[model samples]
Target: MAIIRDRDLIKDWNDIPIDLIKSCIQEHQKSIPRLDLLENYYMGKHAILSRSMGSDTGLPNNKLIANHAKYITDIAVGYVAGDPVKYDGKQVDEILEVYKQGDIVSHDAELAKDLSIFGVGRELYFTTSNDSPIPKATAIDPRQIFLVVDDTVEYKSLFGVHYYPKRDLSNAVIGYSVNVYTEKYVIKYNVKDLNGQGYDVADRIPHYFDGVPVVEFWNNEEQQGDFEQQISLIDAYNLLMSDRLNDKEQLVDAILMLKGGISIGDDEEEAGRTIRMLKKYKVLELPADGDASWLIKNLNEADVEVLRNAIREDIHQFAMVPNLTDENFAANASGVAMKYKLLGLEQLAKNKERYFVQGLRERLKLFANVLRVKGRAVDVSDVTITMTRNLPANDLETAQMISTLSGSVSTETLITQLSFVDDPAKEMERLNAEKDVDMKRQQKAFGMPINQDVTVDAE
Candidate 1:
């Protein structure tokens, strides 16, 4: 199934065929399971299964991989979009107060985390309550929403389809929508509510809207997770890792290697009893000319360790995530040194920042429309979205540098670079407060009146 190249619909999304939308949504359904698997891996819900040979012996140990794929995703996204976007649009500040009122920061972080795992994230804008001052933006799981695009001209996504399940008065309704340019066409049908227990038909037709209220985000144009390709490497590592553990277990509870003719039992029950007795007593009685020797083989621990490390390193390399466990990240590593170690991650973070900032701008544009309808049109185009990495930083070293570069850069530069300062304006206020307190203390120490006002330069 493919999206028909409707060049005519480029400017008018409403001209797109309804059948095309339905076909795309249906075709995309098959990919949902694959997305779910990736999500499950990120959630640490591995599918390793242990097998049991017979009921007592030869146990098949299936251990999950280190799940570093999820680890890589968390660290990358945490360092990239971990911090909230610092709003620089003076006019959009009041417009975004509604977001703070809705706790959009936490929600946006979660969405970014998911985007790291799936390479796709989205936010649906709508009013949550009657008194909602700002429209609420909801983070949507990619699996729940399939983006229909003309594979060739999806760069702008001027026309597309999306389907998701929503709860209605009686049951979960499968809803589909086609977004053209800025308008949205929606249709919904009732289905079993996941559990297949209840059913309700939400009577809704193909409703039309003036705009697509959702803003889609992607890690990049390719929309593939960092560790997605290394999944096979992860599996290889898990297999080898599990083998080493299994070897140790077997050595502790080794198999019985019997030799020569030894008849100690006449029936199955007797045979079982004799086998247990041999193991318990660690002894075996045989004929006068019979002989036996215990058999045990050592596992190649060094070989397994080497293979495990190699696979782990490859996973880290492919994911562009630093192995924090690496001994190279020793004690007292400077912020610059850590950044060097995580150079690839920092670059990835930069790319993510660029892509995410575009989505944020679009969201602002959509919100701007809402605000305009309310007679408060805020041009968020001037707003600069700053993505600060939540990486480890040595505040002392950073302060020293700031002091060294005093007057060279703006004071705002020093405040913004400080890892602890999420908002420069607020940090400035806090610094002033601390400085005032220190000045009062110093005045008392000098036997001066506490009421004396002295400008204490904290520089």
Candidate 2:
């Protein structure tokens, strides 16, 4: 539980007993592999295809089931980190430019998606070069790494170990080892770094802070996902949809039957004949009297619809992701009314916003440290984040509402709420420039030179 200080010798980190490191990994490995499963489910990669019902007999309809897992998570992430979060402070434009150049919005979206997938998402912040336009943040899947916090406090992570593979020059895999991260140091440790005679401090790279460079985005404080509670529902939903499709096929085609004495080759030949007849011809020839009467089935469309609706309702209910395409929400509604409809989503967004803010602050802190090392030190302590929901609302009405707030609201706040402006700070700059041009034109019209500054009291 001791704090890893900059003055701490490299031996303190490297001299850890082999048994202790093994125990740390042993305790957490069991829980790490499930992350891959959850991520696959989110991507609709395996759950639909892998889980098979015993009665997949005739047709090979391998159509994937309704993948609501991806929808719910995508909507949740779209709301959580939808817009680009800005850093507000003097000389922070350089940092903002860096984020813009790096496409931080897409990077954050990937982070949120992984957060939903693995319950824990991580980003590695590092500078590519001294003259790098912006520091890079690489999103790492939780399967390749584990997040470790102090066993006592449970929230303070002093460091993290990333187990990435070491490949040869020809891109052949050799082995994997842990890369240890702290604020002031990043040390690569292999089996040798752990057991070698003495610590080689020369290999360590110094950084700005004395904490880990990894910023984590947790789906929840307990590190659980939105669909975890109703994860089984996804399987059930897919099974039902697949069964329905299979049933529909059987019901409409009317499985051919030979009631009386009739020869139709073997089962494979019968299947091929049936397929050929269904696709090419509609006529069926019955050899004997009352030989075929069409084995029709009544599958109760109402019951299937009920079951499908129930499963869908349960999924959206438990996931807290409402069906945006619901007919009930088809009407064009006010923002406040729509907000009420999205109350559950709003609640989930609040939780995500809280966690996302914590990670973003850590991100800015790393940026600040890197900038300090470059002699362009910036204070981003007071920088705050605001998340705007990408919801359907009447924009003109909202703009009119903002107009009513004349002196009550700040121009920056108004610009943020305007929806058309992507960056409020930059829009404010544009507005000021336009104002200066207008004043210069007015001064020249009044026989006043445009070179002199205009005073407020001079009017």
Candidate 3:
């Protein structure tokens, strides 16, 4: 949850209330356990691994873990951010150049993954030095940074808190170093004690950006991770599969029962010798009316398989992430059919795009403000952010659609719709240049005027 405060409580950053900051820190501290749990799940440290089998009962209890959380998260992340998010508009090239310098594509991918894993992502935009005024942005761990907004209808972001543990020479965390980002400055504070009960100002550094540099991106309206709701289903699947394997192992090591055939001495050593001899000879001589049979638990393999399939299907279905290995996503499927199969994922992506776009717009605004301070004219309002789903497409089908709408739609529009085209404006410019070259060549060949169409008599 985001930290909220009254806007009028503090006149300025200099008069910031220390108690409120401490409270915010405390509130953030409360969320650490949950965030750590989600991170552990993503890293394959599931709750099942911590379970211990009972030593008293002689049964095979296997703690098998399937990292379905990671699988769902990675699929959602790749589907949304496998292709670099595109930014376009008037004077956006300069902003894009800044992004390129900062390697924003990789940063965006990282942020996307964070959103999938934690349901929230954060980014910080800043300028390095006066000599190099180009703005750079980086993805920040959501657990380390939080935006505090005004407690109003608009909920405008007042500032952001980025805190980390302060370490000495021995690498022991003595306290926390907190950086509070405001509209005009980054106010630094140091909490000397382990708990953030009290703090002292370290320094106040001015920043050129006109607003808070940090931006928060939500995965969905509820800010829930892709696999969060399906975690129970995943756990159930893991348990079922683990027990299935345990049953198989038990079957392989089934107990051999000899009703009345075998006779052994009362001593343990004598019984062991008799058992070894029987095993070595691979035969058992029984008395009359005696029988030998293996005592094994009868497992309903068909029922177990059905339950396994059901749980697996529920995990994927509830996660809203398609099982790529499913036969429904076969290579031979038509593009329309593929899209139908991905409709759930498409809906999920749309919700993600809604929030991710907001974050990108905020990032662009920061860049524009910073560039303006550096004496550059940049209008970031008109910028457009485009997100493409990373799914296989039928080029031939797309080509046919483009051909049919060649004259009806703008060439630039059609060009941008093609998956291969990265820059539609540049592509249009190249097309125009090629047309001019072809026109000049025809004029030289037939000795006709440049603007006139050449005519020839047919024999």
Candidate 2 — number of clashing residue pairs? Answer: 3
RMSD, model 3, all Cα superposed?
Answer: 2.8
Q: Evaluate residue 246 in candidate 1 and report its C-alpha lDDT on the 0 to 100 scale.
A: 74
> Which tens-of-lDDT digit does each residue in 332-420 have in candidate 1?
56666766787888888888888888888877777777777677768877898877778667788889999998899978778887887
lDDT of 3 at 358: 89
By summed lDDT, which 10 consecutive residues of candidate 2 come out lowest?
1-10
Per-residue CA lDDT of model 2 for 1-459, tens digit only, reads: 122223232345433444444545555566766776777777786566875545656653655567788888888887766766656677677677778777888898888888876777888877676565347788987766655555453456656656666678999766556666765677765543333333233346765554667777777877887677667998888888887787778777676677656555568978688768756886666655647666877788899899989999999988889998899875757667777878899899889878878888888878877777777878887776777777655688878988899789898888878777777888999999999899889888997877877555765
Ranking by TM-score: 3, 2, 1
Task: List the candidates' TM-scores in order.
Answer: 0.79, 0.80, 0.94
Candidate number with greatest TM-score:
3
Enumerate residue pairs that collide in model 2: 183-209, 183-210, 183-211
Model 1 weakest 10-residue run by lDDT: 201-210
CA lDDT of every candidate:
0.69, 0.72, 0.85
Give per-residue CA lDDT, model 3, range 49-112, as digits (tens): 8777889988888988889999999999999999999887988988898889888899999999
Q: Which predicted model would earn the best lDDT?
A: 3
Candidate 1 deviant stretches above 4 angstroms: 1-17, 50-59, 129-133, 147-154, 157-162, 165-210, 258-290, 426-459
